[model samples]
Target: MCGRLALYSDFPSLACSLKLPLIKGELTPRYNVAPGTWISAVRRHDGSGQLSLDTLWWSYRPPWADDKAPQPINATVEKVATSPYFRGAFAHHRCLVPADGWYEWLAVGGRKQPHYLTRRDGEPLWFAGIWTERPDGKPGCAILTEPARGVAKAIHPRMPLILDQQSLEPWLDPELTDRETIRHLVHHLPHHELTHWPVSTRVNKPEEDDPALIEPLEPSAP
Candidate 1:
């Protein structure tokens, strides 16, 4: 489950990486982005093929849902196509949730040990996501998560689905509906291109959004 993530890069830097036109709205760098806050994402229109960077509320509310149930923040690709709450967006409003890194907690000796995962080169990472806007103007999104691989399995059972440049066009293209293509893209990030390390427990708090939360923790030598 990806409950928290980091986005320390400036908007211009993100725009450069995504190769999108200049953003028209104000943006900010988010180090510890939590659910329910406004976060940046690049989404495309199914019919017009228009892509734009927009701010999406970090929680998902189904069109048929009332105000009581918990807003879903993570959507499983395996079940999204059949789920009542996610089927529409799954087929139509796919998006990319950009992040510099993400945090996951490892259960060690009954205690949660925080870990920060990112590209080894320290560049931005993109998580597959879906979004929707209601008639009243409120919009929300859910990050897609799949089974963990390699070292990530040591941290959690699931990790956000990441896409590289080679797969980005297929992932974002509305014309592409082949599930096999999507699965191939979600296989795993190459080990050499990714890295992870332990971090402080301060990241567990949603209010603790700052640079210090990502400082590496010294691991005891074996």
Candidate 2:
């Protein structure tokens, strides 16, 4: 469900991938990013029609909703386009979330084993996302998710809706709201490009944010 992720790539590479203009500020590498926090995303501005990189609270509640509304971290693909709570943002406020990879858990010996899933080529992944202005007036987002595919299927039943590099601009284009057209233009990255490995369960703790969390857990000799 993309509940947890990591973004440790340097800004230069991120800028190159998003074709983003210069943005001033330091971006500290975060290896264990959880929901209910500010995270980086790229989207087109409402007035300027320009692409921008900025931080968004990683949870969503439509501006019209009350403080009691649900703040969801992930929106299922099957319903996001039609759900009243998400359609507006899906159509007009789509965004791209640059991430190094995401964490998913698998059941093993009655315990949950965390696994890291990333592109085989080491390039960053751009997650399909949508945002809305919260009741408090802060910008918030929810990563889109679809049924798991390829090797990722072995780890979890679902995974983030990662976009193909070529589809990034189209996904962010506010004008492309037609469901069929969007389905035609936006395609998920090839599932085969993804690889997964067992990683330290230390990631379960939100406070644990370091490179070691992604280091592959060595397999025991059979």
Candidate 3:
């Protein structure tokens, strides 16, 4: 599960890189983002085929009658097509959550050591997500997840569903509804394509949002 992440790219740079239309307001860098907060997301509307980069609440709440617990920050792709809570969004509200890197905690000597994972070549990563509007009219999203691979497996059991430029068109295009196509896209990203390094525990605190949180820390795994 991707419980924490960091987005350091300036909005203008990100917009240009992702070919997203310019957003009206400026976006500040977030180095210690946690669940249930506003996050930057790229959404494509089906009818107009237009892309919009906007901020949305990080957790999604379903339309079920019961006032159950807040929806999960991430959803499993296997159950998405059939789950009542996520089927609608899976079909219509697909989105992309962009970030420079994400934080994962590794169990070392019974202590949690934070690690920063990013593309090996240092490119920004786009995580597949589903979004929806609540009764109060606020937008929210849930990241998708799959089993971890390669180096990430040593740290955690699951990783975010990351998509590359080649997959972005298919993932974002509303016309493709077949579950098989979407399923094929959820598998592990190339192991060689990513790199991870230990980072300061400063990231453990949600309020510690800054550039330094991503800086490499020594062999402080314990």
Q: Find the 10 residues in a row with the least total lDDT in model 2.
A: 18-27
| Tens-digit per-residue lDDT, 71-100, candidate 1 | 889998678767878878876778888899
Off by over 4 Å in 3: 19-25, 184-188, 219-222
Task: Sort every candidate by lDDT, greatest first.
Answer: 2, 3, 1
Residue-level lDDT tens digits of model 3 in 173-218: 7876778877676444577798898998888889888898888886
For each candidate, what TM-score against the reference? 0.87, 0.95, 0.90
* Pairs with steric clashes in candidate 3: none
lDDT of 2 by residue, 1-222 (tens): 999999988888888876656453457799999999999998788998877778999999999998788999999999999999999999899998899999999999998999999999999999999999999989999999999999999999999999987898899888999888999999999999999889998899999999999989977611
Q: Candidate 1, which segments miss by more than 4 Å at Cα?
A: 20-24, 45-48, 134-136, 177-188, 219-222
lDDT of each: 0.79, 0.91, 0.81
The TM-score leader among the candidates is: 2
In candidate 3, what residue range of length 10 has the lowest lDDT sum? 17-26
| Collision count of model 1 | 0
Candidate number achieving the greatest lDDT relative to the actual structure: 2
Clashes of each: 0, 0, 0
Cα error of candidate 2 at position 67, Å: 2.1
